[model samples]
Target: MTPREQIGKQAEREYILHGKRGVTPKNLAHKMGVKLSALSQLFPTREDLILEVYRINVQEMNREREEALDRALVDSGGKPLSIESIMDARILPLARRCIEPHKGVQYQVGLSRFFTESSSIKNRILHEQFADLTQRFIDEIERALPYLPREEIRRRFQMTMAAMLGVCGILDMAAYGKEPARSEQEMWKMVHDLRDFLCEGFSAPVQDRHSPSSIHLNDGGRQWQVPLKDIACINADGDYSRVYYASGGCDMVRQTMKAWESIL
Candidate 1:
């Protein structure tokens, strides 16, 4: 590793292992066996050093998450990922880390504070960088949901991430093993809630309840009537939905249900 990289790794190690209590250039310099002045040359400010350490750490974490996703996908034998499997692949690992070894708690708390509290220019830049990188997880979800339109994929992906992040915050609280105390039951509730929320979108609708006669489809600016008995099924394709009926198949309409009603 280059001198710069070596400095970052050492800083991350110190910060994670003991920096939670407190860490300063002098303290880190002492730990690195370097003169304070030398360390200062390498990292001009505390934020600079902390951000560097976090940037590296976030990259490593993203890599691990991606690897887990790949493994989950492979294990499924080319099938789309289930909500339970996705949560297991992504959240459970970190949750385990938070309680085990204890260092993981420190690491998570440090990162949570760095992103939420720090207003440094470098911190903001790193924030955006990680946000884009994090979207890769959403891409994984889209892969698992290849049937959904891009717009629907984005909507569901955003909600799913919101739920995931909330769970992380709760896990972080539990890791402290104190204050606003979380019970074991509460943690399990969060897991079940997340699963149910995602499953609502993926699970077959209660009896595919949309009335066939009431359904109106618009395809390429032309309106079509879909009478219940005449219809076979409605399926989604990439960017388009298809309607299969007794007569044959046609691309599904993009109109809203209400709008379809208005036309009728």
Candidate 2:
């Protein structure tokens, strides 16, 4: 590889494996079998390299999410895919996309940590990019549930996204443990259950008792109802505390509330 390309790929690996915490010039040089001076010449500043690595990873992740979203969209077959279906599709490929120990998920999680702690200028830019990323799927949600209260639909959408990122935040090697079978099974279960529950909540009528838990997506099943509290990882206060409490970066729940306030 050319020097720049080599540096770029190595930088991505380093940052994803370590995030802002992982590596220094000396470590990077040792990993890449180069002199520290040579690495410094290539990377200049650690932050600069980290930013470049983050940019590359975000683009790659977007591509993965898009591919999965497209598959779900195409499979919608003239009908709309629900919010859960979209999320299920988005994170499924991560079984492959997130293969390297705690690489991809850690990068995503730690960057979120960094982002929330960042200055307003940086956080605002991060929020804008994040909102734009979720906007297309949000539009699809709007279309699928036309009569739903628009602002509530969007707030729930934001919470659903927070749930999505929460998985990415916590899926670590240590968390996964040694039993690959158990970890994979649990992760997959998490995906399926959350999708089914949230999609129903998203597609439900505001006052309706029916929920995704009561319905089956696979063969036309009978309609049923579940409590809203049962559908979310919420607290006694009826807010999305479980997910937000675990947010490694920005406060998504509070931000969603702020977003709803702005619109209403």
For each candidate in the order shown, give its overall lDDT on alpha carbons. Answer: 0.64, 0.58
Ten contiguous residues minimizing lDDT sum, candidate 2: 211-220
Candidate 2 lDDT over 85-137, as tens digits, reads 67665556543454345454555554555554347535654564456667776
Spell out the clash pairs found in candidate 2. 112-249
Q: Which has the greatest TM-score?
A: 2
Q: In candidate 1, how many Å is residue 249 off?
A: 51
Q: Say which candidate scores most in lDDT.
A: 1
lDDT of 1 by residue, 1-264 (tens): 987787888877776666533356777788878888988898877767777776776666666777887798799886778766765566665554444454645655655655454466445755655576557666766676666665566666667666766666566465566567555556656666666766665433233234434566667788856676776766656556566777886666675444534433
Identify the runs in model 2 with alpha carbons over 4 angstroms from their true place: 16-44, 77-79, 94-131, 171-182, 207-264
Q: TM-score of the candidate numbered 2? A: 0.58
Q: How many residue pairs clash in model 2?
A: 1
The per-prediction CA RMSD against the true structure, in angstroms, equals 12.2, 12.9
